[model samples]
Target: MLLKSIHHSLDELICLLDQVSDHDYTKSCEALSNATIGEHTRYILEMFKCLENGYDSGILNYDYREGNNQIQTETEFAKQCIVEIKMGLKSENKTLYLEKVINGLGIRIQSSYYRELLYNLENGMHHQALIKIAILQFENMAVNEI
Candidate 1:
């Protein structure tokens, strides 16, 4: 069920991409602090990539993302990354570890692969909402409804 939700979110992202022109995709919105929709989409994809890498290595670090610029500027590249992320999520579940700072103290905690996937799903949706707003502001089109 969680995987299905992630897939659906990614599909919605792709649908939004399909509806926008390349110029619009790269257009930065002043209301959004000059952040382009492509940049938001790229950040979402990289977060999933970080989870996938963390799932394999047992350590999930959001700071270690590759931050591929191609994924930001090219819709096809972003779509490919989404496909790769879905393929990675199909692997067997495993225990993952993450570090967090609590009151300025760093601590490591055990986590599950599925839970990280859920985090990525939610994170992706949050960015998607931002992207939807940028789309509305710049293109005057609604996305992710159908």
Candidate 2:
């Protein structure tokens, strides 16, 4: 049931992403480019679910290893997400969209944090990444707002 909430929220997010018209996408991209942290914050929330809830409806983040002791990082992917968002839409008006996305992230994080505490923390791997992601998102939003 708990995982279902994450899945539900993920579904909502996916739907929102899907519903992004060409205009919205362009706006998102523009917003992302000019000191916007909303997209990154969202990607982290979804990616964390993918890591925590495997085989579930949640979209899981996966990385491939090219060679021995070589691991792919999400850095490129993160940058791409921003670029992609920018490509779709011209940047949004700072006074409104930023506030909305940031507010949405706060709600999503609260949902995920509880889900992790309920299902993930018990016999789970290091939760540091999740914490870091959340902190970064929070920090990014806060930093941009200033």
Candidate 3:
């Protein structure tokens, strides 16, 4: 059952890619991976870490490792900032840490939703945000109509 589910997921993902144009596919894929969104909806997600010794002794600052085949020119500031945010979770303050995690998730969700909207707008998909909204809002709108 698990393997079947995995296979179905892969097939669905491939079909999604095939349905969109090259540009929309690329944009949506990158937006999925990139927390730092772009275009009019420039939503930058925090990494939950802080860089620079000023923030924390363990926080990495300007230590761009090489030969690991990673993004060569990663933003050190952003990386550190994320680290700092993560450190906050380790603190005794549960409420604060939970809030940070929730906010981060919300930001990620909004970015992807907007990306989907943008891709549909660009690639001439059937529905933009309104279509997606309607589908979500639909109650027993399926063929069964129960």
Candidate 4:
């Protein structure tokens, strides 16, 4: 069921991407402090990617995203990333460790695959809201319902 919600969100995101022109998709938005829509989409995808990469290792580290510039500069590449993320979401739930740096110290907390998926869902939604705000900053821009 959670996977269904995540897939639905990705579908909506893909639909939104289809409506965005290449120019608008990579245009830096003042509302986002000069961040592009593709950048936010990349961030959203990378979180899930971190989870997927860590599923086998049993350690998830969000601070270590590869920061692929292509994902931020190419809208089609970002869309392909979303599709790949959906494909990778079918793993069974398992015990996982979320490793993070807090106050200059690394910490690990027990987590599960499903729990991280939920976190990714909420994170994606939050970024989507920011993306909407950025789109509104464009002159004569129309945001389609997603």
Number of the top-ranking candidate, with TM-score as the measure: 4
User: What does candidate 1's lDDT look like per residue over 21-137, in tens digits?
Assistant: 778889998878999999999999998888877766798878778989888888877888888887877556788898766798877889988888888888888888888778877
In the range 1-146, model 4's lDDT, one tens digit per residue, is: 89999999998888878777778889998878999998898899888889889988989999989899887777788889989999988658999999999999989999999999999999999998899988886676556554
Q: Pick the candidate with the highest lDDT.
A: 4
Alpha-carbon TM-score of each model against the true structure: 0.88, 0.28, 0.22, 0.91
Better structure of 1 and 3 per TM-score: 1
Alpha-carbon error at 93 in model 4, in Å? 0.7
Backbone collisions counted per model: 0, 12, 14, 0
Model 1, residue 109: displacement in angstroms? 1.8
Each model's lDDT: 0.83, 0.31, 0.25, 0.87
Weakest 10 consecutive residues of candidate 4 by summed lDDT: 137-146
Q: In model 1, where do residues sit more than 4 Å from their true spots? A: 100-106, 139-142
Judged by TM-score relative to the true structure, which candidate is superior, 1 or 2? 1
- Report the number of backbone clashes for model 2: 12
lDDT of 1 at 35: 97
lDDT of 2 by residue, 1-146 (tens): 54444344333333333333332222222323432223333434433433433323322222211121110123333334434432332221111111113544522122333443334322122222232233343222221110
> In model 1, how many backbone clashes occur?
0
